[model samples]
Target chain A: MDKRMSIDEVVERIPNGATVAIGGSSISRKPMALVRALARSDRRDLTVIVDVGGPDVDLLLGTGRVAEVIYAFVGFEVLGLAPHFRRARQSQAIRFQEWTEYTVMAGLDAKIKRIPFMPTHATLGTDVLRVNPSFREINDPFGEETLVAVPALKPDVALIHVNYADIQGNGVILGDGHVDVLCAKAAKETFMSCERILSSEELQRFGRDVQILRVYSRGVVEIPWGAHPTGCAPDYRTDLRHLQDYLKAASSEEGWRQYESEFVDVDHPQYLTNHGGPEELVSRLKV
Target chain B: MPLMSEFSVDEVIITTMARQLKGEVLVSSVTAFGSLAAHLAKRLYAPDLAVLSTPESGMDVTPMPTLTLGQFLTDVQQGIPLTMEDIFDAIFTDHFRIWINPSQIDQYGNTNITCIGDWSRPKVALVGARGIPEDTSHLSETFYYILNHSPRSVVQHVDFRSGAGNGESRQHLGPHGAPTTLVTDLGVFDFRGPQGQMTIKSLHPGVSLEEVQERTGFPIGGGEGDILSTPPPTADDIRLIREADPLEVRKLELMSGPMAAEKFVNIYERERQTLHATYPRVGKLGRG
Candidate 1:
């Protein structure tokens, strides 16, 4: 793999109207630099897909780049509702479709297997399966009517964030890995941002299983403080402060741009240090 | 008109009405029927206290008098015998939870959560027993909210029962008890009916026989020809629940009228567009 490119070089690679898939649940382990870059790009008409809903969904939804979002739950749990997704759905501002939690995961699995659609009974009988034509219930080999027919969701590009990677795009997640690994495997193109770039020997110290470099990754960027409030591998604690600010900005379009202008469009990642340290980052991002 | 305590439907109404009766009871208000129940509760019976849980939190929003679950658990560990009143206060004191009903609940009135798919090889998979386990197994009193009635939700046999208040899960629950009542848009229902088959208790005002049939999945058991309209909530119900909590009350108002619900969704969309525009992902490395 090529050595890590400057943040601006990475920013120039991403264009408008891309169907991008983000890894991690909610705000955990999201590619911070990519998110910053996207926010700075000011592109629109984006289609995004995530497993379970979270603030990452909120950020894009709030920014107006997302023309469509597909997921299961959007609300904060039930405090009120996914006020953002709810309001959007109510007004037809963006297209809304929901899949059972399993189907969404399995869809990625299906993509990994290189299948158009995988058959498994997931959301059968419920309104969720019946409403979506893309999903179907087919009989198994035994002629038994079971299995939810789930179409694969192969994203055009996947933005993955992790703990570490080599200059060659080899990476490590150091935890459950969830769907992040699967996202990398399925996406046609992948941009992996890591906390640091490890030498081949340092990566060897972690052992072979720890590394995730393969045909899937195209570029690797060393973003030491990339995850920020979001959790990094080995080190616990997500960037709650930045997440809070993201939530607040995401709650409204005007508020989102103000946030975007400050954190996303910086000339360099070092500006993150001067614009105030971690404390400022957290406080400013908190809604 | 019969008081809410008299019929199955009344029991459902009372669950919400009791909240109003007490001054203010928490209602989930997720679906159309739930919103109606909360609206009625706010109108007729007002509760003294109410709380709301966000989606960020779990869907189960029963509140305890104390702060966190750990605190209550600690109190229990210290030989503090938790009382029915303590549990009821916790559940009754909350705003609402989104619930799903099942076809043919089991002996203890527990609903089905298991699926045809085994852990390994499975035909169909479901979100088995999501909240039913906690809501029925632990909560003092649980509300079984059903939006549409069909053999699916109201049936002779449930494929798998998760939370048992009286029957199988009963052994599991030991003392936590089970559902307090079942509320449907058509009418309130009671699991106390013959063989624990739900029986109709009361009907909402302006509801007709045809409307009830259209909404139900089971054969109507009770509230025969003599059924009467459920009493509408008084003005006090509105002032306390609706006017009192702006965030929750606003949602209640939005659900009050279909047109209003639609309007709320419209405003929600414009905001979504704005968010997406602000955080556009750049080139997005990918094969596509």
Candidate 2:
């Protein structure tokens, strides 16, 4: 079965008011192309779960498509606070469900394992338990202690980016998977976009620990420079200059409109061209 | 900007944090200003502190002021990549010391980063439960380096439980101990009592024990009514911080306003570039 789909078709499957878990490290390996496509689409009222939120949350909030954000921390790292996210937060325009890095990790892990909830000692005596009803303290029948139970987060979809993948959906990431692999397993469906799509033989040559098997992938989009602005390790570095510009432009509604028009409104080819072509990105990868 | 006639409040806070790390080798997890205090402590006092500013920043000997992908790649280039996967051993096995800022803390040292009021509907929404939750119950040791020393922050009970402490730690954290030290703008607190409860260790210079009690939401424990003046930052501490942060980026950590968050981001970018050039990459990754 050919599990290959266009970016639009993959994004089209995500309905309005759906919950999505995005896979990436802060300032790295983000599915920028897919995020942009979703922003430009008619989708609305999205609920996002990310460990460290950056432009993914910022853009959706900027476009007024996001209704809530579930996050551990949300910042652009050195690039600064995510402008749209910060404003929305200050204005109380959206609801926020805060989880610790581990809570989100364990929540997704439980979902993947098809468990109702996972037991953890985290957030047991902390202030986090007061607000989130999803996290409950239950007696560890086996361990003789009370622990926090993190309910499974079975997201509707998981939008992920990897360095290399095959049309069949098997993929390889050059760097740390973080909770990306877990997100893929937790979601009902996972759509991947890769920098380069290799054959099954090629994926086998590179081998395990680095590979994400086709079994987890529902569909794969072979889009080069898919994780633009933010980077894919070994493939390219973060487009820092463009990101700085985004930080400034996203601070205001007017500035974000210009950014939204020039960058987000266009399709993949035009988007790559507007970013000074794939060749320019290739040149920026000296590090 | 607290109008320090003789010395600023950070001097005492940073010194206390550095002093805690003295004579110990620790793998620490910190963010923003806490990283600075930990770095300074390692540079001047600890000498065996490994700070994981970011997973990509890995376990660098001397943590850089700004953590960038370039710096991360360089660190990765220097040795095998120390990614999030590596954190398992660091947190559970090797036991990384934790340095964090809690929005709300109770008498037992239980922390809450989730929200301020009721959990269902919060009065104020701050950063969510992150590292403190899991690490609080698992890490070898935990420390709170908070800036706000007010009733709103030092509460009788935290609205949410983000990191476990006190009897809760004994129940949930297992063999990994609970928090031992707390360094705030008001004073240094020690939890090494018969029962693990926060007590005023020493008041900052010019601060009265009464002032601390007046601000704290809970009944002040341990020191009772008589706590000594915390030793002010030595000349070396002040000199090291000044030389390290010429623009005083440390001031941003103290700001309470919304606009300060924006300015902090801008300042961070500008400072990161300049500071990355000078960050001392001391010995190898494993050595620290």
User: Which candidate tops lDDT?
Assistant: 2
**Docking class for candidate 1:** incorrect
lDDT of 1 by residue, B154-182 (tens): 55545545445454344323444455666
lDDT of 2 by residue, A1-287 (tens): 57899999988899999999999866778888899999999899899999867778778888888998888876676555566766666667888777778788888988888888988776665656655657888898986888788998879999999978888888887655657888888888899999877777666665653457778889999888888788676566667667777877876778888999999999999998987887876765323
- TM-score of the second chain, each candidate in turn, equals 0.52, 0.83
Q: Count the backbone clashes (under 3 Å) in each candidate.
A: 86, 14
Candidate topping DockQ: 2
Question: Which candidate comes out best when scored by TM-score?
Answer: 2
Chain A, model 1: TM: 0.84
lDDT score, candidate 2, position A130 = 59
Q: RMSD in angstroms, all models?
A: 14.6, 5.7
Per-residue lDDT value at B147 in model 2: 89
Q: Measured by C-alpha RMSD in angstroms, how accurate is candidate 2? A: 5.7
Q: Write the per-residue lDDT of candidate 2 for residues B1-288, one digit (tens) a residue.
A: 123555677766877777777544345444556656777788777786766545534465455444333334333344334655466546655346756778888888888765566655556545556677767767666778788889988888887777787865565556464877888988888776566878878878778877888999987776665667777777788887777666566676676444664665466456544534554333221242
